[model samples]
Target: MKLLKQIILLFSVGIFIWACGSSPINNKNIEKEEPVVIANDSLEYEITIIDIGFNLFLNTIAQPEGYYSQEYLETRNRIFVTNWNIRARNPSQFNDNIYENVIDYQPNIDYGYDVNYKLFNYFMFAQRKYKMTLGAGYSRRIR
Candidate 1:
């Protein structure tokens, strides 16, 4: 009886150690991500985002295209961009690395659905990856 208990204890410890290993199998097999460009040729606006795992997040985690109306996306983007720009300007108060550049998103100009959708999803990816809130009043727990 004592021997069986000892064997079970060792097995439990081994399983625990294996579970707590630093690198997971999925992380080891991750593919490299390329920069994603958000552009509107007709409007002559372009933005390139180069961040690791953003592509994966965009495709796998974000809501599907057409899940949100363009107007809704634009409204949320306006709020997010305003807060992001504020952080970018005041780097001392926020993480300088995260808010490196200010986005030039004009409220009046129409960027079309693709541009707005990609931009909004990028903001969502950034929020999740950095674990920081871009728009405090807006919901950040989508995922």
Candidate 2:
């Protein structure tokens, strides 16, 4: 009985060590590719951009309207800056080329005032910082 317990203990330890020794598999040879835009009209392009931007904002910010204080917003903005820095510095860490896609295919359309404020601001920041041409002349007046 003692021998069986000892054997089980050793097997458990060996399994644990083997698991710890394994590393995540990364396929370095697989090249990252940009999404192909097939929209025929500027409206379709604009809508796609808005959709992507809004989704990104929802995933990263995730704050409800009027729920956060000014200080919290500032802190969150700082966190965004940090995350952007990491992405800019380490492109390999990301699998998608959404950044480049946004720069290349962002539409020039006049959006409604309340349609996509958060995404607009995000793209505006990207335009200013990264010199991306994100429909600068095409956006409607923000009321």
The Cα local distance difference test for each model comes to 0.89, 0.44
**Evaluated with lDDT, which candidate comes out highest?**
1
lDDT (10s digit) by residue, model 2, range 67-126: 545444444344444444455555676434534342222223333222234434564445
* Candidate 2 lDDT for residue 103: 28
Worst 10 residues of 2 by lDDT: 29-38
In model 2, the number of clashes is 0
TM-score for candidate 1, please give it. 0.75
* Residue pairs in candidate 2 whose N, alpha carbon or C atoms collide under 3 angstroms: none
